[model samples]
Target: MSHLVLLSGWGCDARIWQSLDGHWPTGVAVSAPDWPGYGARPPLDEPGDLAALAEAMSAALPTDAVWVGWSLGGLLAGALLDHLPAPRALVMLGMGPRFCHPQGVTEAELAAFRGAFRRDADATRAHFLRWQLGGEPAPRTAHRRLLDLLGRESPAATATLATGLDWLASLDVSRVLADPPCPVWRLAGEHDPLLAPEERARADIRLAEAGHCPMLSRPEAVAATLADIAQRPEHSLLEATP
Candidate 1:
């Protein structure tokens, strides 16, 4: 049987998939482990090293599972393709090869945020939680939903959170995704403010009337879409690209 591995974005824990509760298509085994140092997970000795991070992460993730990674998690998952054995398929949701660019925040802006995080990690996490909901039709409602899903899980340690930002500021998955070891799919929310135009043009699927946090605002739709994707041949996508 095929498995489903759900990867949450930075600042969130496995609960990010709360919306999909009772909505996942039956029969697929699921795992939504937190990244090292996030939630109750222990921080790796070298949390900043992508290779080490991926290796530590691989133990909990099933190699044959279809990996669905959201936002920063998606980007990092792409990076992991080089470290872990090829997954059955990789689904990059709501992100592109890079985050610090013209379509997203600038390097300087990200640097500023990193510094801010170091000073007040809790405050920075709260502010970021609010910022990412901008593209939803009702930002306030989406924000509430996001908070509810995140629950009381403490954000990663200041240093761990800072490391995540560093990855966002520098890691680029273009080389890997250009010729991924396994089937790769890119999906984006129609109104996702954080997505790059280049990604918008190439995304294999675009969820309509959705935003950056589509899984929050459109849980049923997101779950249904994933169910559909699960039905496809493990190694192939549709003949029509975007």
Candidate 2:
């Protein structure tokens, strides 16, 4: 049986896939890796960046696992793809080639997120919901659950992650996709403000209306896509350089 390793976006818990449980295609065993400071996992040290953290997390999975990631999780999945011991596949959701602005982020943007994480927790939560669901709004019950997760997070750690966007400022997957050996599928919401539709269109993308977090809003469709990829044959051997 094939193993599916799910990497979740920043600040989100493994609960992101709760709705899609048991929906994966047959012959697949799905596991959602808990990001540092998120899910039930312990937080990492101050200097532990995503790359270092990813290296540590990858040790938990078996070699050659299919990686499905959303947002920051997608970035990590792509970065770690070549390093992993096994065959890999990438399914990116709601993430563009670069997250930070080309010229770089202003102090205002960075400070605002930091302040929201500290003084006005509700606003931070609301902002996150707005960004992820494209203002479609999560249910009140689900929204509260997300709030709990946010409450559990360390402000310093989350802030450090916010500061880390600079690492992805200039990243684009075009060169990587130019002649990808492994199968890659990109999914995006037409109204996704985080990752524009135009950017996602650069890859083999699926359009939906659920904003950034379609896995929650369009669980059935996302589940079907996962199943589709799981059934496809491995393509790593096809990536040999000419």
Candidate 3:
């Protein structure tokens, strides 16, 4: 059975992909990792941020596996793609190659949005839910589910993650596409506020039917795509080909 490891975006937990069993390939086993400080997982001591966290993850992965990452997860996946010898296939959701401009996305609007997190923690979480859904009306019920996952996280963890995002913001995936070490597929929601379609022209981008958090809004679609990638030989070939 193929091992498919799904990674969630910043401030998100593994529950994002838990509802996707119906959509995953029957033969494949799935596991999604909760980020450093999110979900019920324990927080990182001091500040051994994403890079250190990623190195630890690389050590734990199997010899052969496919990686599917969302938002900040995508950025990390790209950064650490070479760390594993496994046949890596990427499914990047609602994320760009970079988080800042030139190499990534760092629009004033987005910077301002990120800045809000440091000021009001409650409002930040609320705004995050709304932003993930592209400013659509994410009612209290929706937030309840999100909060259930996020409530366990420490604000220091969130802040540390936010600061560490600078590394992701500076990545350039254009070179990866020119000579992809693995079969990388990009998935974005048509209404995703953070990552627009135009910005994702390089990879085989699939425009799903939701917002930034398509895993929450459209789990079936994302899962089906994942299943396809897992079953296809071409995807495997790309990662292993000399």
Candidate 4:
């Protein structure tokens, strides 16, 4: 059976992918479990340790399922290949190895946001949630959908958010993407004001009429693409032809 485990990004819980529920192809099983401190799970003492976090998740998340990660979650999923049993493959959505890109959030901007988060975590997270949706074709509609999803999920603690920021600041998966251990597929929003890994991925991988939160703005399209990727051969025979 083809199984998929969806991971949510920072500032949001697993419910961020709530819009994609029931959209997957038949026979494909899916689950979006909360990261530590994001839902019923208690906040970890050190949320900054991606490897450790992935290790902890390994107990619950099966290694056989394909892992689908979004934004910061995408980076975390990429790290999973090293710590836990490798999943069938890795699928990234509107995310890249580097979060601090000139086109996305720069180092300076990230630093400033860190400072702002320290001062008022609530305000900073609220602004970020809205900012990420600005590139959607119908920004207000997307924002509303996100808000509704968030309303059902427990908010991450301020300390957890700070550590998440640190993860974003420190993570750089350039090498992994360059020579992925498993078959990897990348996706990004054409209009994303944040990180757009457009240059690294195929042109067709860029979702139209979407932004950083394409799952909210274009859930059906995202689901279709993920299903297509999951069904492809992990090591295509075509690649062996010299």
Q: Work out the TM-score per prediction.
A: 0.93, 0.74, 0.79, 0.91
Candidate 2, 1-242: lDDT as tens digits: 77777877765667777768766767878888777666566666753465566566867555566678788778766665555643456676666545644333334564566666577654574566645554234545445545554454533355444543434453455555555546666767665656544565654655565656666666778888776665566664233222
lDDT of 3 by residue, 1-242 (tens): 76778887765667756657577757888888666566555566644454566666764455467787788778777767655553557667667667655433356755676677667655675566655665223534445656664564443355555654454545666565556677777777666666644764444645545666766666677777777777778635464322
- lDDT tens digits, residue span 83-113, model 4: 7776777887777777888766889999999
Comparing 1 with 2 on lDDT, the higher-scoring candidate is 1
lDDT of each: 0.81, 0.61, 0.63, 0.79
CA-only RMSD, every prediction: 1.9, 4.5, 3.8, 2.7
Estimate the overall C-alpha local distance difference test score of candidate 4: 0.79
**Order of the predicted models by TM-score, top scorer first:** 1, 4, 3, 2
Weakest 10 consecutive residues of candidate 4 by summed lDDT: 233-242
Candidate 4 at residue 21, lDDT? Answer: 88
lDDT of 3 at 192: 65
Clashing residue pairs for model 4:
none
